[model samples]
Target: MKLGRHSPAPKRQKCDHWSPCPPGNFAYRILSGGGKERTATICFEDEQLVGEPGSGINIAIVNYKTGEFSSTNFFHMWAHDHSKQMMDFIRSAPKGTLLLMATQDDGSTRLKDYAKELVENLGSKEIKNIKFRSSWVFIAAKGFNLPDNIQREKINHSDQTKNRYKGWPAEIQIEGCIPRNLM
Candidate 1:
């Protein structure tokens, strides 16, 4: 995968102690209309899970219209494991659903794979109206990272919702990461 000029390089933050550290926080600057006036809280305490330093991955998704959010933790499991549940939820979503896919700096590749599969399956006509729009998120973590190439590959493979529909306007926030503020 080609790393677009806009792609972010690997980043990390150091902690002074080994004690349970707080999860990081993430916010997205959303562009609407002619100006960027909206900011959404992508990660909150309710969306995080605590485990051994590096035991699992936390994934979160938010409904743009209702600001409703849903999250899950994947531990020693493949993204495909959640296919059924994820598909069910997406199918029920109204048109113009913006699904955001986020992950810990380390889980980026895995999450991207999951996103790719979702787009492929949804686009194949096996499902209807359940289209994957676009995904955006910041990758932050203390250690372990996804190579820039893999990240780009996944993003490119996933279809952007905007390009797929005319003027459908629904945003679904999908986030995957360990909240820096949640320990």
Candidate 2:
């Protein structure tokens, strides 16, 4: 007599199946000189699986005087590991290099920590040169509660401040030169 066929075992689910996985590739477009330009996706994975995405955040440095610009995006972990690269980009920035923060509330803490770490690693000397000199903008999908201390300090030191766009949740706009005067 023939034996009955056995069914195959069910495959186990991946832990990250439900988690939001990083995008397969990152895309960016640069607009300069009244024209639009597109760049290819920096490959995040390789055939050998030896390489991964460079970073999760994008840094754009625009040289207003010459109208030239350069930008690169890095994986979140790379920010710490590649401090020198980050510093070099910052140091090489030309006048009017704007530091913009665009992220959802879920990544706010990471963004804040990255900013703070950048400030700390760049050292007080470097920070002094760029903190107020650079324009800082924070775009959020949802309103974030700013701690009283942070609010007070920002208000006390920042030259200009604006909050959320009309009908928007909690977008914060901070402008003006650095408030070095704040103690």
Candidate 3:
């Protein structure tokens, strides 16, 4: 475990008290107890621009033990056409699993374009809109960190109301950039 911290090589795939890797690294992990947050990283490692420098990876943890969802964000442009592997990794999670994904709104066609890739590549039968906060978007499995009633309210609306959602996240916008605070 200590070696991970001292390795100075690159990223860690798993987490332990000695060596803790963040949520986005494929080797990221949690403590021995199930109560700790658990995460799995999804990477798009290609020559494509999305996988290039200045890009980052962030995963929202679904600490089911606590029934809470704390989100994170990474702003990067995805120039690829599709990512079937990423979609499969997301869908592979158990229904109650609180797996989440988010990215900053870069104010470009590429953002929506990558979103479209998700909608098309997803293998799940159920359909749900991604959550939008200031300048961010969230995609998660059904029943992911939401109570049944609130989740229903969100689902009923085609687009987010102009008003803010819980004073933080708002419904996602299909065009234009997200507000400055959101970014």
- Model 1 deviation from native, Cα RMSD in Å: 17.5
lDDT of 1 by residue, 1-183 (tens): 977677564443321122332444333321111101222223332332222122112333444333344433332123434444544554454442233333221222223455446544433221122223222232221122222322111222133335333332223232222332221
Report the lDDT of model 2 for residue 84: 51
Per-candidate TM-score against the hidden true structure: 0.28, 0.28, 0.31
Q: RMSD, each candidate, Å?
A: 17.5, 19.3, 16.1
lDDT of each: 0.30, 0.27, 0.30
- Top model by lDDT, which number? 1
Candidates ranked by lDDT: 1, 3, 2
Backbone clash total for model 3 is 3
Clashes of each: 16, 6, 3
Q: Give the TM-score of candidate 2.
A: 0.28
Query: Runs in model 2 with CA error above 4 Å?
Result: 1-55, 78-80, 101-183
Model 2 RMSD in angstroms: 19.3
Assess candidate 3 and give its lDDT: 0.30
Off by over 4 Å in 1: 1-58, 70-80, 104-115, 120-183
Mind giving the per-residue lDDT tens digits that candidate 3 earns over 1-183?
A: 355445466553222223442333222111110001212122211111111122212334443433344332333335542234444444555455444333332212233444445543432112234323223223334433332221111111223343333323232211111111110
